[model samples]
Target chain A: MSENLPFLVIAAPLFGALVASLVGWARPRYCYAIAMVSLAAGLTAAIALLVKVSGTVSGYEYRLGGWPPPIGIQHWVDPLSALILVVITAVAFLAVMSARANLQLELPGKERFVYPLMLLMVTGLSGMTLTGDAFNLYVLLEITSLSSYALVAIGRGRAAASCLNYIIMGTIGASFYLLGVGYLYLKTGSLNMIDLRQIMIAGDMHGSQTVITGFILITVGFWIKMGLYPLHGWLPNAYSFAPHAASNLMAPLMTKVSVYVSLRMMLSVFTPDFLAVHALWAQTALLVATIAIIAGSLIAYSQTDVKKLLCYLVVAEVGYMAGGMWLMNRAGITGTIYHIAADAFMTCCLFLGASGLIASTGSRHIRSFRGATRRMPWTFAAFLVGGLSMIGVPPTCGFFSKWFLIQGAIEGGAWHFVAALIFSSLINALIFFRIIELAYFKDVEHEDDVSHPPQVQRNEAPWGIRIPLFITSVVIVLLGVFSPRVINWIERFVDSVGVT
Target chain B: MSDVLTFIISRFNYWIYIVLMMIGLYAMIAKRNYVKKFIGMSIFQTAIILFYVSTGVKSGATIPILEHGHDIGHAAAAINPDHYANPLPHVLMLTAIVVGVATLGVALAVVQKVHDQYETIEEPEILFKLGQE
Candidate 1:
């Protein structure tokens, strides 16, 4: 079971997706059960893998069909990869479980197709996280992109157009990534990331024009996919317009997966030594990350729609991760890794809560949230917890990630990043607090009745929606309490790589 | 001057690739029609295939298939036996081609959806209507 864990973790969801797609034709309602069961199994395997790999000197590398590295496709499950796999599968499990009711409401007749496509998207994401071959990453990236396009367009009317823009931008990003791989293959003779790392170190090709070109192309491609600043034009509308369940799942996972890809490439594929030896590459990364952080926060502050605001905040959160990676220290890289999970949970909580709000009142505008707390106290309290996490307040997962980042900045003597992180946190707090105040304090006059209604009402979101939101909120708090242990695990893993 | 010219000619495939890639990129950025932009994207992706294939070409090379009389020891040796072109790039390009086609299919579906909603594929007109909404 342990030997087959890597394949099982990825293959379970993929096999389930295929079965669901085919079997769903006979009984549509069964698709939800199939997807949830598959994801639950995958989640169990991932957690097992994480425990098995924790505090180990070496990582697990499983080659397909018994072929060796550079020839056969391999799945590398280092501590970092194991951690990300857990995050992806865990969030996906919760999202699919919560999505059943929302899918019935939003997708209605199309619920069958939604379940299979959602499962397929999970398969693609897990494949991307688990694979070590560059070309395999591209294939998995496409699978995810194709399913996401379909999922986004599942909404009526304007969602189709937004999905179209997302496809276009996403295609460009993937193409650029392919081109970079092409350049890399031309220069060095391998596509396995570990082999490529060895070749890069053995040869003095760090500052060569070809290697630099490949680096730029790959970085730009990932930047676009991660929705960094100027390339983030497609995110806000796409998230805002997609059906509630789709937004909830995608808003938390997609860009974070892309960020993980970028970090893997920078640290594992291109090694810190390569970046350190190349002045232009390091400076360019630092510059772009700074710009993305500032720009994403400012734009997020200006959004009026709840989902759109969260979408822009995703953009800013990507910047924080990207900035930490560019810092290129143990503290910075560990923060980026921890933030991936922290941000995933925090974003999940917020989106799930927002979905509940949307279910209660079919409106997504921030102004429509006036007096929601009185009507939906549990959901609102969950939202408040999510908002505090987003603001990086103490006793939440978000704060510890920021703490590591600020400490990394200080160690690097880069006060500019420290300032940018502080500014972004301030803006996040202001924006979310404004919504909290509206939901709690504002009065709503009932026009349907002769008298003013009481501050509290009997209305609350359904149990299905509230359960997931509550679970994620509790996870965020637990993650905060256990931050030191998690950070230690990540640091040990980073040190084992022997890079820093 | 002669060395520079030699270098340019040696990398002629990359130069043509660059030219084709630039054309595709310009059209993707400048065109308003969605289908046309998608076509441009396909062209851009295909150009990389050409660039990659070109890079694998040796000055005087045969195909990378194993032959009985070739006396190559293993698959790696067969890759460039008698100065044959590298097969790694070819294998990678195969995957890229499939991804390109998948992207095109999704793009076409999205275009169909856009047509259904706006009743037009023109960017400016769609923007105007969306603004009005």
Candidate 2:
């Protein structure tokens, strides 16, 4: 049973999707309950798997259908994958906790399809995290992308247009990934990641032009999927226009998982030795990451819509993780892995709270947050916690990730990356402070509030939204307090992978 | 010049696939019509499928299926190393084809919705209307 946890984590959602789509047509109301139950089951399996993996020097691999590697596909849940699997399921659960409210207001009668699509998307995401086969990863990536395309299309007012753009960009990205895998297959005749790694090392294929081209193609594919910098044209509109419930889950998981895939490609499939052989590639990637950070931060600073602002912030967070991963040092890998977990939760909490505020304030503009602290104090507080985390304040998970990232840059002598991190943090501080001021103060044009007694309205978001937001905020702080333990786990994984 | 001709002729499949891919990419990027863009996407995906399928081809290889059917030991002893073309790429591309179709379906549906809402499927027109709204 313990060995089967990897398959079970994915199976729970796949089974739920089947059941929901089947029964939901007749009884649409039960779809939400089914989705919740399945996600909860997945979360449970993921946590158990994490616990099991944490006790081991190396993690377990469950061969599918009792078949061996290079031929049979397997579920490889190393400590790294197990940790990320837990984050994916946990974030999905939290995001779905508030879906009941969001969907009722937004779609009204479309719970059945939405729930199943969300479940399938989760299935694909978790499957992508768990699979050891490169081809299997591509299939699962399509499953995720296809379902998300539909989910994004479910949004109101210009969503379909954005969803079309997303589909076009996403298809190109996924196709490039397939082409890369095909190139590798032509070279090695094996689709399994571990087998591919072994074969490449044995065959001395690192310097081979085909293998190098495959690596670059694969990296660019994931960069597009992850919306890194110039290739991120499809992201902001697609995410901001999607339904809140969908965006909350997609925004955090999609890019982070893509980052994880690239990292997995580097550590597991391609090896650090290969990365060293191509030092120029890593330097170029880091430079692009630096530009991504500066550009994403500046664009985020310019957004008037709160949702769009968060979306741009997500773009910048991807830069942070991408830069950290490319730093090619132990501290950098640790920071990247830790930031994966931290940013997922931070983005989840922020998006959840922002959706709640948008619902309550009846506007998407930043100015709609005026006097929000008096109206929905709990939601504002939760959002503020997320904002501070974004700014990398101490005692939040964000700060620890940034600390490791900067330490890595200093160690690697990449002063530009360190400067970019500091610059992005300062910009984040400015963005959040501006919002905080708007939320805490009355409008400046109507400055009669200083002399008169202000009436504080207690119009808070429902418990559905507040509870998840509160839970995520608490998790952010707890993760921060327990950073050393998480960092230890990450460092162990990095060391085991021979990154240093 | 003869050597370059031999090189191009020997890898003509790859060259054709690259050409098709570039054409598809151009249409996807430059075309204003949604349907044309999607057609380009299909062609782009088909080019990749062609590439993958082409990789499975061997000069004198037959189909991957064994002539001995169920006699594994006998077949293993009798079969030559290069007797069969690889079947995995075709199998993988079957999945890719299904994914391509599903993506096309979703893309078309979104285009229909866009047409319904804005009464146009042209990119610039949609942008102009969205800007107005």
Candidate 3:
């Protein structure tokens, strides 16, 4: 079972996506069932792999077709990969479930195509997490990119244009990544990330100009995909204009996956030793991360649309993770890994809650949330939880992740990063609290005559959407409580990589 | 400096690759039309493919297929090793080409959808409509 886990993880989703696409033409409802079962199986396999590999210090690498090393494609289920796989599968499953009603509401006619495209996107993200070959990663990245374009275009008017812009930027990013891979192949003549790492360690290619250029190119490409500041121009409109279901699904997971890819490249392919030898790269990452934190927060605070605000917040969170990676310490990497899971839950909860708000009130603007607590108390409560989590309030998962990240910064003697973290948190609080205040405190205006008072209806979002948001909110708090164990697992994995 | 210039001249494909890359990137950033942007993206991606293919080039190499009684090592001894292009980049570029085409198809479909919704392909016009909403 353990040996076949790699094939199961990739094949289940690929086959399910094919079936869903085919059957969707005849019976659209079957698409949801197919996608759910496929992702559930994937989640089970990922968990089993994580459990089996947890006790072992050395990571497990499964090569397809029994091919070895530099020649064949491989799937490596290391601690980091397993952690990311769990997050990807979990968020994907919950998002697909939440997407059912949201899709019906926003994209009634295109429902048949949405499920299959979403499944393909899941398959692509799964492939990215599992693959060890750099070129294979490029192929899978394109798979996700293509599906995401289709999904984003399903929104009402002008969404298709936003999707087009996404495709353009996504292609440029992927092309840069491929160019970087070409340069790496030129220097080392290998595509397997582990093989490339070994070659760099054995050879004097660490300081080579070509390798440095490759690093810069690849990092830039990932920065674009991860929506790092300045390159984040494509995200707000893409997330805002996309259908509610599509935005909820892609907005939380897409950039996080790209960030995972960047972290994997930084940690696994170019190890700490390489970065240590070249401290200038670390300095560059630190500087960009600081700017991203500041820019993402300020921009998020200025947005009126709920989805756009969350999109900018995603940018800020990416900076936090990038800052963690730049710290290059055990604490920092652990914090980075933990935050990946925490942020996924927090972002999903917020987006799911936003879906509810949009459904109930038919409004996406923050100001339109007036007196939501008095009308749809459940949704307002869910939003309050999600908003609190976003603000990094205690007893929520967000606070714990930020705690580790700030500690890591202080430990690394990067006090400026510590200051930036505090500033970002304060801004996050302000952004979310303003929304909460509107939802709770705003006076309701009666448009009807004085004789007929406007009656407050206690209509909640449908069970399908509300259930997922509630579950994710619970997970956010649970994750905070169980953070120590997760941190321990990350530390063990980092140690296995021979990093202190 | 002359030796460096000689080496660089011998590897003139890299210079061409760089030029093509710059052109693609410039078009992608400067162009406002959606289809033209995708065209730029395609050109940009193809430039990377060219870079990869060039990396495999040798001064006098042939294909890397092994004949009977001749392994990779023995075949290398028989032919001038510098003449045979590296096959790895070729293999990698095959995958890149497929990915590029897939991305292009999706991008074009998205442009078609944009035309259906907004009846305009210009970026500024689309933004104007969006802001009006």
DockQ of each: 0.74, 0.94, 0.80
Q: Can you rank all candidates by DockQ, best first?
A: 2, 3, 1
Candidate 3 stretches with Cα past 4 Å from truth are A446-455, B1-7, B67-83
What tens digits encode model 1's per-residue C-alpha lDDT throughout A177-286?
98898788778888899998889888977877888899889999998998888898988888888888788889889999999999889888988878887766656666
Clashing pairs in 1: none
Per-residue lDDT of A243 in model 2: 94
Measured by lDDT, the strongest candidate is 2
Candidate 1: global Cα-lDDT? Answer: 0.86
After the best TM-score superposition of candidate 1, give how far the Cα of residue A395 lies from its true spot, in angstroms.
Answer: 0.8
True contacts kept of 2: 1.00
Best by TM-score: 2
- Counting only residues 3 or more apart in sequence or on different chains, how many pairs clash (N, Cα, C under 3 Å) in candidate 2? 0
The TM-scores of chain A alone, one per candidate, are: 0.97, 0.99, 0.96
User: How well does candidate 1 score on lDDT at residue A144?
Assistant: 92
Predicted complex 1: CAPRI docking category: medium
Query: Which is better, 1 or 3, measured by DockQ?
Result: 3
Poorest 10 consecutive residues by lDDT, candidate 3 chain A: A443-452
Which candidate, 2 or 3, would have the higher lDDT against the true structure?
2
